[model samples]
Target: MSDATTISQQLGAAVHQNGVMNSTGVLERLFSHLFHGLVYPQIWEDPVVDMAALNLAPDEDLFCIASGGCNAMSYLTARPASVTAVDLSPAHVALLRLKAAAAQHLPDQAAFFEFFGQADRQDNVEAYDRYLAPHLDAQTRAYWEGRVLGRRRIAMFARGFYRYGALGRFIGVVHMIARLGGVNFTPLLKAQSLAAQRQFFDSQIAPLFEARAVKFLARRRAALFGLGIPPAQFDKLARDGGGDILPVLRERTRKLICDFPIAENYFAWQAFGRRYGGAGTALPPYLEPAQFDTVAHHAHCISVQNRPMTEVLTRRASGSLDCYVLLDAQDWMTDAQLNALWEQITRTARPGARVIYRTGGAPDILPGRVETSLLNRWRYDQAGSEAGFARDRSAIYGGFHLRRHEG
Candidate 1:
């Protein structure tokens, strides 16, 4: 089958629940199309919080959605036995494979960081050719080598790679709107205290949400498809804002900007600056220099698959996996789908195995949806969930849940 056809089929299985004649179905197709390419240049789910909740050990195995593959790569720092990372987007799968190859082959931290950290240097293309290209599979190689507007896609590394993904473009639009409103986000980076950050947001950034145009666009689910928020997830987010998305967005933005110091929150840097802050700035664990060797050493333990989590768990033996990181993908699932997924999760979970997931709204999604028989097998850590949710530097998700298998 053709690549496009294959992508559609994969996405359709997970995302298309309503008929094409319905608005929900149309939104689903549109999201699927947008997601066919890179959606998250950097996964927003904080791996630090994820690792803390999982309390991973060297012998345990993990299964996680590989959005931008950052968390999967970061998990390697914990020296897990294996990380099975899955995604429906071919682009995401290819990106993870590329990161793995780079981790294994790149000469040093300087070269590696220049390619992925600076991500805008022309030498990155040459480095990819010299160091990374030969190790890649034919599919991944072709993905990076493929031309977009007369330039190879790998050259995106040479042209600000983080700024080209769907989420990146959405942030770019937000920046544009801020500029039009005479609001400057750069000043937030300069704020030395949380009080100062709050002052800047209150006086400069918060009013942008009150704009009629911003409110109009916020109400439409399509506008958030760029953030990888599907129609199903958008409804839950709106419900958080009392039937209006603007308040939810504004509050989320406030948390992102003011709840954490900019120097210590890479998510904030990505949102306001569209790139990672350098030097003293916080970075994804996988990108930290101290963790580089460990990541490189454990890179071989990660396996990237372009598919759904339930399909993968179904193929595993009972009690095989010790950890599962669902991110926010469950927010897109139907009740039956959620139950099917939880069935596989319960069937494959080892004793004391933990499952972690986030929701678009402030509640665990599994109860009353998955069978009580299946749900009862897991012990929900309400306090841990609250703690994880509070510490999540990304500040995009409304709830973070941690559940341990009773087995």
Candidate 2:
């Protein structure tokens, strides 16, 4: 079966088809449709992991791929002069714009929390209509009001906005699988320490990997579409797993479900529990009430653009941006594209400009792939990168890279 529609712009179709699942025309189309929508209802990468790598200055300008816009919102805490959030997907750009509007206009922290932090309340609808809709650009407003299949997209907030996007539906399926295996690990959400988390995982979640049904289902590449693992990335994961992706998935899921304490681990809460947590829970930085005023004040500094990031950098003035957040987009680029991206990054970066990205497989996806002339301008921070990868709460990505440009 064909799984892609049209590949996301700037992601070469030639690469998409070389892989098994994405090779067929129909499958390619399916991937296109999935990519075109909200892949990450909440982002998969941890911003705190990133914050430790890319030390920001107040005068700096940062360019980031606004996947679900979570990190962008969180990055506002860094007090950068500006954060340019771009994406090839129009839907994602719309999502960023809507979030920015809500952050800027929502009357109180409680209202804002209910709308985005809680993310599953009928009041969010009223909050959207009252505080956010008028502030949204025409494109974004239309997107929220638009219909997907038959349902109006705006109503998704009332029904649990976190549960609607491609990633949301994907997580839902994983829960269904866990239920079928008779291993409900939801009790782990109450675990007080990493020791407790590990104990729970061993007793409850670990057995699923041994189950015939799970091992059978996990072998298929198509099963992880909701996790937004594109075909090229899926190929990387499959090889790392020695032909079957089950082992690779088990290790990553272990990190997500067990390595971190749930009280501070919002990513695990969302992935397994589908909600952030009850009141007084430790949440993502942007969701913390203390940070709300700061994010709102700086929300004006963000601009959402629907375009390929490489093209945006190519068009920018020399030495304009101080940082770039690639967010695993490099995994989708061909060698030529990767070099071109580095060329633009080198040209536009001020002295000490940092580039941070995650990889589905290799940490050094750029060393051979990117042109030496362009790659030489930057130095990869191996220590910081390794630490970020280890400390990352998201646990979905295999590599976290930080490179600094020298003008």
Candidate 3:
């Protein structure tokens, strides 16, 4: 399939191109296409929490799904020997490649910071053309340069890139819902303490749930298309939410709002404020000045492949990789696909290799899908996963799983 159509093909059977709309048929494919179009402009999982579980070393090799390239770039600060960003979406691969190129070739930390840290700068287009453009591969170059909706995709840098992707648009939609329900969450971002945050959630944000529209949208999978929750995963979400997803959403939102200090939580900043907190002390590690040199120096360690996770792992040498950051991709896979993935991970993972992933809903994904014989090679760190899930500042995932290769 061409890059243009890979998304629709990759999400095959999930969305019906010609099938008529039944209760289930029409919406599934439409959502699959929507999700595949712009799944995450900003990664939803916390790389800080991910790094803690992976315990990356200077010599360790890392394999990660390069969603938004945040964690891929952030992992450079840990001094990993290699970080491979394997993704299926052409858009995601292009974005990751762009970040890697920018981090490497941008003149100085300040200019670099302006390009990505403060991405809404008007000079970003010039910066991209002058410095980063030459460094990008042919496919990645075409992606940014290509016109869509009568504008270059790279034009988003000047017009607020962070607020454009599926996740970004989803946040915008939520803000709209909140406003229609008579709640303005901007005050929540300014809350000085957890007490104030909680106070706001209860008094203001909480009432949105009581609104008939909000509740109705919460029950409908189509309403969550922006969050990248697919039809199958939506079913899983409702099931794990005890057949009603409102309380689950409330708990998750509460975590996003109050469980972490706003000063330190970039996810909260993006969710409530629609921006990174700032470039000061609270920025994503990869964007901070202190970490800039390390990330730039090691940016060459990263590589992007627009291929399925299974295909990327298939050609790799056994016992090569030391860390795996799957994000929530596994939530969409079938039992056979899950087994095929672990088979390669098991073969390629080095001793003491740690695999970290998130789930839409869970106990865990591997119990019946991946056979015990294959799974026995790895040790599931239940306690660590629970701790990591709680520590995940993103607050969007149901569970964070940590598995170690004990073979």
lDDT of each: 0.90, 0.81, 0.84
* Higher-scoring candidate on lDDT, 2 or 3: 3
Quote the positional error of residue 386 for candidate 1 in Å.
0.2
- The C-alpha stretches of model 1 lying farther than 4 A from their native spots are none
TM-score of each: 0.98, 0.94, 0.95
Write down the RMSD of all candidates, one decimal each: 1.0, 3.1, 2.0
Model 3 lDDT per residue over 294-318, tens place: 9999999998987778888999999
Q: Which model scores highest in TM-score?
A: 1
Better of 1 and 2 by TM-score: 1
How many steric clashes does model 1 contain?
0
Q: List candidate 2 stretches off by more than 4 Å.
A: 1-26, 149-151
Q: Write the per-residue lDDT of candidate 2 for residues 275-377, one digit (tens) a residue.
A: 9876557577888888899899999999888767777888899989998899887787678778778888888899889999998885578888887777888
TM-score of 1: 0.98
Q: What is the lDDT of residue 298 in candidate 1?
A: 96
On a 0 to 100 scale, what is the lDDT of residue 37 in model 1?
Answer: 90
Lowest summed lDDT across 10 adjacent residues in model 1 is found at 273-282
Better of 2 and 3 by TM-score: 3
